[model samples]
Target: MALCEIVNKIAACGLDCSRCADYENGEIKKLSRRLQGLLKGYERLALIKAKTNPAFEGFKDFQELLNIFAGASCGGCSSQNVKCPIDCHAKTCHKEKKVDFCFQCDEYPCERQFEGKMRERWMERNNRMREIGVERYYEEQSKMPRY
Candidate 1:
């Protein structure tokens, strides 16, 4: 696909939907399914194993992480069924200003934009997008290792 087409997956808040854990065709979904099966198969065995191995004590935590990963898969912000407040707000703001992306706004990195870890990550991404431009930014994001 063209770089612009790939980069167009970027949400208004600067998050690269293509790189998201829940993004279509991403590894997280496959990993989540595998982990679910493993967890189910190992449930009783893990408890027994934990009695002798301290390492097995983290099985509960691993299960929690598995749940998180399972829930991370998304069809991107543009999915009609999903209601993402951040993306919604960003879209509204950009539309009001008649700008294409958040980076195009005059108050690009305003304090109001930084809220939680997700927003913070997007903010950093926005900075990178500004530094490298969309195509290069997409290339760079695509190169990063996914969980």
Candidate 2:
């Protein structure tokens, strides 16, 4: 099949879909390891640098980094951005009100929680929206076919 055709068939998270491990799972592990090493070294450096570097000043408490890393790495909204009904609902609702993901709406589904496969995607995008914002959500989501 052609590239576009293949890509179209391949599932994606639309918003944070690029965050998935996918074929990059191995790379994620390697990069995680490297980041851990650099972070460890940075931690050691941060101790001394915090007295000088403004950047380190904010991160003076190494416990904060450890606390942040204690949780899971965000994957993506593969279903929220790709699944059938959820994708349809998101697009239709957005177009109806002329906004991006539910985040922009005054009446967002704040009740959403990690439940079904589709919920999993929302969990990721809900978090990603904080980083990328609603415009990117609509932009990426719009590229997707309605069906």
Candidate 3:
């Protein structure tokens, strides 16, 4: 695929779908799975150490969190496997309007699927995409932390 096509995982709300924790095979899930593997035998160690150290008592909760992260999988905004935690209106709006990104829409900053810091981010990202184009915007965002 072309670089543009490959990184076309940008969401309608200007978020990078690949950077989402729920993204299938994304970095968060991959690292969580690897860490689970590395800590395979740590359960027994935690059990033994829990008798001597109270801090080790939280191992069960830690394991639960790790499992959640490791099991996380979603196919992005456009996919059927969309597991968005929020009540996202951007995706539906995009589909109805047939726009690839919010920046491409007639009403870019409409009140939908964004609030507080996310609203700010949406405006900034869309404006950046408008100024530099989606490909360049994606390149610039690729070098920064998602959150």
Give per-residue CA lDDT, model 2, range 1-147, as digits (tens).
Answer: 343432232332233233333322224435555666667656667768877777776664544554443432433232233323233355345555655445556655544333677667665665556467544554565466432
Instruction: Indicate the worst ten consecutive residues by lDDT in candidate 1.
Output: 78-87
* Global CA lDDT computed for model 2: 0.46
Off by over 4 Å in 2: 1-16, 20-32, 60-147
TM-score of each: 0.63, 0.32, 0.86
Give lDDT tens digits, candidate 3, residues 1-147: 255563347887777888888888689999989999999989899999999999999999999999998888888886667887766688779889888788888887887657888788778988898899888888888789987
Query: Of 1 and 3, which scores higher on TM-score?
Result: 3
Q: How many clashing residue pairs, candidate 3?
A: 0
Better model by TM-score: candidate 1 vs candidate 2 = 1
List the pairs of residues colliding in candidate 2.
13-78
How accurate locally, in lDDT, is each candidate? 0.68, 0.46, 0.82
Please report the TM-score between candidate 1 and the true structure.
Answer: 0.63
Output the better candidate (1/3) by lDDT.
3
